[model samples]
Target: MNLPQSPNNAPDADDDLEPVGPRPRPKGIYALPNAITLSALFASFYAIVMAMNGRFETACIAIFAAAVLDSLDGRVARMTNTQSAFGEQMDSLADMVSFGAAPALIVYQWALKDMGKLGWIPAFVYIAGAALRLARFNVNIGVVDKRYFQGLPSPAAAALVMGLIWVVDDAGIKGVGRVDWAAWSAFAVTLFAGLSMVTNAPFYSFKVFGGRRSVPFIVLVAIALGIAVVSLDPPRVLFALFCAYGLSGYVIYGIKKSRGKPVSVIATSTDEPDEEGLHR
Candidate 1:
């Protein structure tokens, strides 16, 4: 005879179920973009090593390579729909190494070091500026204007400074003698690049050139010509181009101000640093 089942003695339907604990946290990361960022970081590290070896020319080239790879990673992530917060932060860190620390160190070693205390000061200033700029950009990415950067981008700033070094080195103008005006020029450019990163000047982003936007055939031709020019004299041509771009923000800002148009780079509804003055 079977015993009658009491409510307390009954087998529960949930007997086979495992007790639910806190869910295991996610540990996966997207690989492709991070790999690219890592490569860029290595390029920067290589630059530093080359600089240490007194291979200044090779160091400068490595920094440029890092810049190119840095530029590509983000676009690749976007195009592949692999965007992640991890990727973004990784990119920023890689950029700091490639564009911020590497350039400052290379320039200091190549030219500024000869100036003694004066040398390290400008290098420090540039490194600090790059740090602040990267921090600000990370915070402002969502709110800032898509078409303009709030200040000179750290990469472009690095390019300007490093490009000068590369050009001078290529020209065999070692900043070591009474004729080393090139060293003085490097000093000035380092200071300028450092200061520019923290300014309110709006630099065109060129983001519009990406995506599915169509361009005239002349644009392609212009791009081809640009590549050809860069190939002809990498150091001189690239430095000149970056130098012009570094100055362009000021010109654009001046034009907008004269026209009584808004000059703020941030597009948010909140008050930006130059917004009030722009309106006035």
Candidate 2:
């Protein structure tokens, strides 16, 4: 034991063993899904730009475009097996801008700006709700039911607000900024969409359709007809659709409560950082 170890026969030190904590993040992120996310980010920026230029309808369209791209990025990441912490974080940030900030700013510019200091109230509330919603989503993602969302998804919330803008603008209704009714209408929509994002009510996620599960043939046919109808009148059809969806979570909550079934999509605690409450 007192003899020096021969170079070739030396015992390895503890430091020579591999480190035991989480492995280092991969050298770089995958390009494809991040690219989609970046594109969504760009669309959100473009929406803000369009809003600034008074092209509110075009801005609404860009928000919808961003939502579609947002949906694609996650699915693409999953499909390609390229999911990463970086991608998740990036997607969350993009959603904050696209669904949260952009819609608030757009609606404010289109209608709320003229209401004096009160104009900023709804906008601030909306952005705050979106932030809270996204943060909770990150914390609860691992514990929530895959088939349902614990609250109204940010994308759908954006659609609800932007859909209103699109419909009003498409109707060629002018000078909404000067019209109290129009401004109040935007006020109501922004408030509803914003608050819905933070609620514990369950909203169907439609992820059930993503698997190898088979459905009735008529389901596909109905989807095709739905597409055709939307094509016939995008602004109205889309606005109406989102309005129904915007209320869907509360409807689901009511139904579940009536049946004495658990209404929350959260399977465990929803408290930040460490789920503890198993939200009701």
Estimated TM-score for each candidate: 0.86, 0.89
What are the per-residue Cα lDDT tens digits for candidate 1 across 14-123? 97685588875565578898999999999999999998888888988888888889989998888987888788889998888888899999888888887889888889
lDDT of predicted model 1: 0.86
lDDT of each: 0.86, 0.89
Clashing pairs in 2: 269-278
Say which candidate scores most in TM-score: 2
Clashing residue pairs in candidate 1, if any? none
- For candidate 1, which ten residues in a row score worst on lDDT? 271-280
Query: In candidate 2, how many Å is residue 181 off?
Result: 1.5
lDDT of 2 by residue, 104-210 (tens): 99999899999988888888888899999999999888888988998889999999989988988988987897977888999988988889999998889888785
Error of 1 at 170 (Å): 0.8
Which candidate comes out best when scored by lDDT? 2
